[model samples]
Target chain A: TQLLEQSPQFLSIQEGENLTVYCNSSSVFSSLQWYRQEPGEGPVLLVTVVTGGEVKKLKRLTFQFGDARKDSSLHITAAQPGDTGLYLCAGVSLGNQGGKLIFGQGTELSVKP
Target chain B: IAGITQAPTSQILAAGRRMTLRCTQDMRHNAMYWYRQDLGLGLRLIHYSNTAGTTGKGEVPDGYSVSRANTDDFPLTLASAVPSQTSVYFCASKASAGYSYNEQFFGPGTRLTVL
Candidate 1:
């Protein structure tokens, strides 16, 4: 089974601070996706990185995929209170049944005003 | 647009009881999935259906069963409920026209507690 491990299981920071979350795996994936989930709600897709060494930016958030396709990272610049939530990383492998995703434990971010 | 709707927003049941979680999507997405979220575990897939009339097991398929009779409804059944099965269940659907990069939209989720 392919497993994705996220570092810094929990993080608390003040608004305007910068933080980065890391997701690492030993198995290579065809694509990796990042999601943000709030309490009482399912995850919402934030971004998907498909190519090795690819980088995608969405306003203050930036995502990068490892050159080996075995890891990914999410960096939030000048994070705000609205960015506080659970961030998850999921990997899609080739020939996966129905394109099943292997997810990381997640990083719980708490931003204080 | 009511992307997805899950029945019985929350349910509490006794151990050894049988329960089914109903999920439906109106987007006509070809792929539907069932996942359970627990503290510290994030989310784990229980079952998935690429299309109607087909079902496949996911990372944590034990104690769970699913069926896809048509394009919109996919229900997950638990033959015997256990405390270990208590968690938030989420139903998601995605259009398959795109490659592996398709986005998945999720429902509000169902919170189930087994006593």
Candidate 2:
């Protein structure tokens, strides 16, 4: 069973449009991370949020950790074709000491030029 | 420096055959993990090692096995390959706890097919 759930599994929009993806879980987490994966390549970490109610920004991408530590969201502004890829969210359980990370299904995004 | 490397970028194996996927990291990370990615299941952990000489099972560890002999290498072996074992496998490593906030460096990946 999947511990985390992601919304809008597949998304497609024209360039310059903005989009947001959500990741939710019933369990609390110590840290949550967002990764962008290109075709045939491993996932690359985009951002990591540790504290609840924290917001981080990387260029035009904004990431927010829910105040309850049970959810997170990723927002990309002025989406470009280069932003097209698979977005994944992973969370570290509070009880995880060995660094086990639980992952969500993933959101495949496509930005049309 | 090469963060991580995986062998046999892609392979085709027959059922009941034994195969092993190799992963090595030069970062000397204390933790290593093996994950498999499928269509809708995303990435599922198979096994992990917190440090050399220690290994533990992850969410999905049925037909797979792993061993960490040293700080640099972790190999995952499939004693009996099955069609269900077909998937893209990834190897990842991270700095010890308290040093890194769950950011994992992943290898390119290995695509395996069991017939």
TM-score of each: 0.97, 0.97
| Tens digit of per-residue lDDT, candidate 1, span B21-107 | 999999999999999998899889999889899888888999999999999999999999999999999999998723578898899
User: Which candidate has the highest DockQ of all?
Assistant: 2
lDDT of 1 by residue, A1-113 (tens): 77899988999999999999999999999999999999888899999999999999999999999999999999999989999999999989866645678889999999999
Give the 10-residue window scoring lowest on summed lDDT in candidate 1 chain B.
Answer: B95-104
Quote the lDDT for A70 in model 1. Answer: 95
Candidate 1 error regions (>4 Å) = none
For each candidate, how many residue pairs have backbone atoms clashing (under 3 Å)?
Answer: 0, 0
Instruction: Give me the runs in candidate 2 sitting further than 4 Å from their true place.
Output: B97-100
**Residues A1-113, model 2: lDDT tens digits:** 43989988999999999999999999999899999999999999999999999999999999999999999999999999999999999998887777688999999999999
Q: What share of the true interface contacts does candidate 2 keep?
A: 0.60
The sequence of per-residue lDDT tens digits that candidate 2 reaches over residues B1-115 is: 6799999899999999999999999997899999999998889999988889999999999999999889999999999999999999999999773443768999999999999
- The local distance difference test score of each candidate is 0.92, 0.93
